[model samples]
Target: MTNQQDNIAALLQDMKSSVSEFEQTEDMGILQRIDADFQRFAQLVTLFLIAERDTYYGYFLMSMAFRTNYAVSTIAGIRLGEYPPVFETNPLILLKYSLKEILYIFCHEIDHVVFNHPAEMMKSNPEGNPELFELFNYAADASVNDMLNAEIKHGKKFMQAPKGVVTSKVIRNKFRLSHVQPLESYQYYFDLIKHHANMLGEPQQNGIAPIPSGSAENNASPNNNAIPGGVATSNAITAAGAAGNINDHAWTFATEHDEPASESAEAMAEAVKELLNEVDSMMDGEARGLMPARFSTAVARANKPPALNWKAILKKYVGTIAADKVKTRMRLNRRQPQRFDLSGTRESKTLKIVVAIDTSGSVSDKEIEQIFSEIFAIIARRSFELTVIECDEEIQRVYQLKSPKDLPNRVEGRGGTSFTPVIEYINKRRYFRDALLIYFTDGYGEASIPRPLTYRNLWVVLGNTSNLSVENPYGLALPLEE
Candidate 1:
């Protein structure tokens, strides 16, 4: 047993050293920050699990990526089945926000993972009412805030894996959370969680006091801790004894709280919106008080169904996308409208084309048909034989299309989507000299494609391309107008 313990200890030390080495090698400190955040999450989950409250596992699955359709603090996407959790960082966001927000962002994702809340928040409510969706947003925001607050009260911070030891900021690490109004968007999300828990007969701690999302009114809350010189935890200890006993305390905490319902459908939802309002009020008062209400008030102004005008939104988002992303486009053959002029003139070059497609179940039948129509139109107009391949995970169908009618009745395989085989085929099958590969996807590719040869790759993303992070610095990403 002693030898086994020693081996485990040695392994952990080695792992930490390796991580430290990697952090140094990659100047991007985001990974180091992520590591810390993940550690905190593991610890929090451990407590919850010890208390026999495992429902919060959803938090780990949540992710916060930098480039998104919305400028909102974070966005989440869902997939079916249990998979290891992932966290993706947006380089642009890291440069803008404080390191604290990054930790907050990490916590937000961890909250999703801990709660194991599926990405149902993004889906339209069963009633299909936009108001319900808004309400749901509020509830989620509230829940998230509540969890963060609860974690803080417990003296939790991002630590290392397995043994979550505090390595960085305390709950008092005030980023937007401290100054921003309480029950603001994400804070509201946390609040909603607590509220829903209460509605289901859970405990509610008073005196922690709630503040308006944007209001500076009554900033003197007794519970608000000021780090390094702030409120000290009465029970917080640096020793392993404290850490080891966390599970026991968690179990005790569970006994003190009310029993959670197996389900609290409507009430849970209502809690979400109120929370959303609280959060949004802090960030953009007009958007929350005005835009949302306006969107709800009379007839829906943009009620065309939340369709994507990619050309329009992309144009707006392009200005905000990092310079590195723009430079990535420069390396690819596809072109966006130039913001500046290059002093030297260059001659136009002709390129071959390859079209890879994801024929997955999440893709609507009509969407697939429309995508085919568009591709055929583009191919018919252009003077090239479209090298078309259909895939879910592996290359299921391959066609050298001379005419649009050559398209198959159905691209087989309804399994998981993978982009590797088609990418390998394109890079290796040298039939098309200087090919421009336009991939049509619902943005659900599993294996990522490497940077293609000389601007030849074009992700003609069909659905929400925001769901996928094509990490290639030279990848061309253009989403279709849904």
Candidate 2:
């Protein structure tokens, strides 16, 4: 036998042994039927590897935790963030497809992870709005399928995407958007869909109807109970029905009453970085070159450092604050070790920061959430006093936050925006004299305001930096990325 054939045979045998061991330990009556389905899946994977030997070996290597689960919501799906990552499949559903189509679906799930779609979708729809999440899911599937089809056109035609699969063409035709490029970022597609939905005056203001509970669109947990003959339960069948349009985007966000298996956007990005590094280390030059450029580009973009290092900037400014020092007799002075009378000095490290949020009509809910999330993360890492001043044209509320949990569920303001009130309020307070003032705004207010003389000013402008930079003659103006 050829070396590749031998390798495949060894893999198949290993998988059979693992399944047999599982069967011996478990009391499930349908283990025999599951074993049959797993054998078929192994055969399909073998055929897939033989047909597209050069293209997806790296992906298979990266995804070592492949399993056959009859209860998987979709025909096939990948759950990332775990080491080796889990690739689960409903073999019964996959058995309906041709080997070529099966291969296409397998790669489709891998591409979703390779493109960092789940984390991006989660970041975009932080509120976990089911309809918006579905929109992102559609967009992500389209982008992946478009890229896969483009590759097929370039002569790697071992696999063919099944009919009715979500693609860029389908999305464009559905939305009547003829101008969108064949391949665009997931965000591009999502934004385009949202804009189109808004223009059409669709329900929910953001477009797309709210997904009802237990609906096919709702990514709730599947009923794992198999019929007497090992047929999928109702919930699993419902998910399988929507396989053409949705490939288990449940990994992107948490479902009601269930803890998320997925990581946060920041954590997921780090996981992707590690995955990419591992893939690169495993693949030789020829294999690496055979991989699509889009995959590499996506990885680079996803792993790219933020344009502005907010943490470093905050540290640079906050680190400059002088702390109160007191003499202690615990140790000798560094200046003169021989002088026993002198004591070591200990400096108290306590930071006081006054944050002014511009809760004007122009600032969006998403933007406000972003600002607060960032601020919470920054403060969570240090011992600091946070005084939040919510303002629009005037100060609406003042909060002294002892912890992130102490933050209010809602804030006042949403009228006009003005920075003067916040500045004047801080300047007039004796306690805020030593605190650094950070004004988080959309840079839409008066042309200029009286700068604070008692404290340092850090103007964090959302979206555009030009307005804040041009208007504010003093203090540092930093751009807060959307």
Candidate 3:
């Protein structure tokens, strides 16, 4: 056998070893289907060997952990056989019904080696750059879709498409390599592999497919050398494991596998033992914080106050006083003060302001800082108890903003635009009467109505009037005129 075949065999063996550990009692049908698929793949390899006897190609098998599937990676090196390698008469078609698809996928992988696509893509793009990979995946997916659509339209069996017809046209048309930097060169190939995996039934661990790195620099090795999520390592691999054991923060498993069947079973008893030890260590930190007479350190820090002027303090006090006066005048004799009211309380009813902030890519850091400052100022002046809910495709984070300081240290998330989460959040937390939901966002979000919640919602749009027509059903969307 050639060196390429030898490597391929070794890769297959390693994958089998890894997958053997998974308790396969439940998915017998799936396992049988996979075995059939492998048999088909093996036949294709036999044909490739007969056609090109001495060609320098390297093949490796990968066990797709998430989908419980298998895949092969073939790399072409030095040509050991003659050019335009002749095919055997009785070539075994791996996927009999979709020969064209199988061929396209095969050629796509081979092109990675032939064109040095991985290295080219890496040199042109930065490591872990999602945008570059996204562009590449879309391009490849579009090309594959176009072919699929054409086959359906022509009523031609896709398998009938002739071999060796693969072209780099899609890759070229999709990404402008000339304009790209060297660091990004790896992304195109990575995207190609990732998209190919998706096209195949076997997907990768994170719903996000991984792009294989061309060089050692591009290798998509795990950040921490770890086994598959299901298999136990030095520790448990679950979010509960993370919460119980702080050191297990890096441990990540699929959502379905988050709660294991036998968390306290004898087989997994070792994990529970180690997890308890880690929990003890974490609790020690909190235990120290709760120690009585811990106020001395805090008092020492408070004694040395940073320089502050009466003018600044006066401005702050005036705003607080003015807000308090407005509240008192509005409900002078109508409402009685509750027992919880203090002498310096700013408002009779705490302002339940729902601060909805935009987290789209268009929002700049400076803009964020400025907007946060304004929100903080308003919250501080009005002494408003805030419930800041941020959304962008959905409500990514919901933070309780009892103090103005929370505005500065809030979590940031950015992506697609949707306003449903904001409305949904408001509707859910309807107990806050006299609650005003103030949303600070670019008016590019979709219109969404707040469900029958007890809270009053308001949208404070942060963008030019040109895009002000975006509808909001929950409350009046007041756009900030630039």
Candidate 4:
């Protein structure tokens, strides 16, 4: 046999063995129907996809992950392929759903890949709990489903609302969060679910219990890696080992198998750029409309903080906070590297930084998550005496985080928006003096400057509004694109 054929044979063998948990099906009828429906489904979704995102070209490159294994449980999942660069799925299970539902599910899978759910979650938690991982999946689905439903309502004829499960809109509204991009939204929901899991224990672990909604970021586990909620809906009930493991964060499975010889994250990024180029000429206003500016902003966010890097901004303002040059005692310290000048040392100062987040009704969970991630990154680098004030119309909770682990699990507040409360607290108290005030907000509320501004402020606004409507000539107003 030729080398190519031999390679194909070997790959097929590897797949067969890895997924050899169940009997290979001989149901030709189901296979034929899957093939037939997928073609029509693809045709319809192609229009919606184009209408949705021109950068979402990765959808066309996916192949089926459906091995005839009973372990996959009828929960249709898309696995990122590697060896042959395809998406793997179980077609038999998908056949049971309606054409609209099938189309929605397929589109949802594409959204998963396009948004880089698996990679992002892995980045967030490499050894994330399996049960928690599944809940993250549901949160992601809810975020995307909310976006899709929004577009459908706006006039996307081909798409429809997803059938079941909690939605991002519901989560955001119930908590009084603002509209953040999808990536942030997913994280926000995950945090909520994580809180739910703590109160009720993992839904699956308990069999079933209604999740309670509470406000505040205090529910965080000690490790600070916990994500919220899992799908305990009856739909999630399946045969043993069918739903996959916790690391099955997205289409790319973990315990089962991820794409073999699959494209690396860097390679996939390059391929997406090429794909975007290929489709650039075909895009029209209609397609562009489907790809709303908000959604585009969201996809952009999953990469790195867009347009403005919150990291760089933080550095510019606070990077040089504490520095003390002094002579070191190298001879006494055996652990110091011999190549280093251990004799010379500088003492790092403890920076007392005040982070005031707008937890108003308008601020979204995704927005909260994004802001929290940035703040946590700062804390992760070094110890900061962080004073976090969660405020809506008024302050809801306050956290004194000495270490990154001490960071709270969620943000609480859904009242009307305002900056006065946090600013007033910062100014009225001498304790907050010399503290760098970083206000994370959407810049939509009553931002009338506090008379005789007592401290330097950084107003970081989230969402489409590029500039805060209210003028703050005293401090820098950094507008973040959603």
Q: What is the lDDT of residue 343 in candidate 1?
A: 33
Cα miss at 24, model 4 (Å)? 14
For 1-482, candidate 4 gives per-residue lDDT tens digits of: 33433443344333333222212333323333434444444444444444345434323432322232222433444444343333334433333334445455556666665566655555454555665666666577667777667656766544444344346654554345576344346777777665443432333310111111221221221121221222112222233223333222343433344533233443444443343333333456565455546545544544453365455677666775544334676433346656465564656465668888888766676666666667777656665677889998899988786655555666798777877788787778776665678877777776476742434567777764454665653676666652
Question: How much is the lDDT of residue 216 in candidate 1?
Answer: 31
Colliding residue pairs in candidate 2: none
lDDT of 1 at 213: 30
Off by over 4 Å in 4: 1-71, 77-85, 169-184, 199-248, 251-286, 298-482
Give the per-residue lDDT digits (tens) of candidate 2, residues 277-365: 67666666776677768656765776687676455577677778666466899978989989999898887677788888888876666
Give a tens-digit lDDT track for model 1, residues 27-135: 2243334344434443433343223222222222222112111111122222121122223322212212222333444455444423333224423234444333333
Task: Report per-prediction Cα RMSD to one decimal.
Answer: 23.7, 11.5, 23.5, 15.3
Report the C-alpha displacement of residue 293, candidate 4, in angstroms. Answer: 2.0
What is the Å distance of residue 355 in model 1 from its true position?
1.3
> How well does candidate 4 match the true structure in TM-score terms?
0.42
Q: Could you tell me the C-alpha RMSD of candidate 1 in Å? A: 23.7
**Model 2 alpha-carbon miss at residue 117, Å:** 0.8
State the weakest 10-residue window (summed lDDT) of model 4: 206-215
Ranking by lDDT: 2, 4, 1, 3
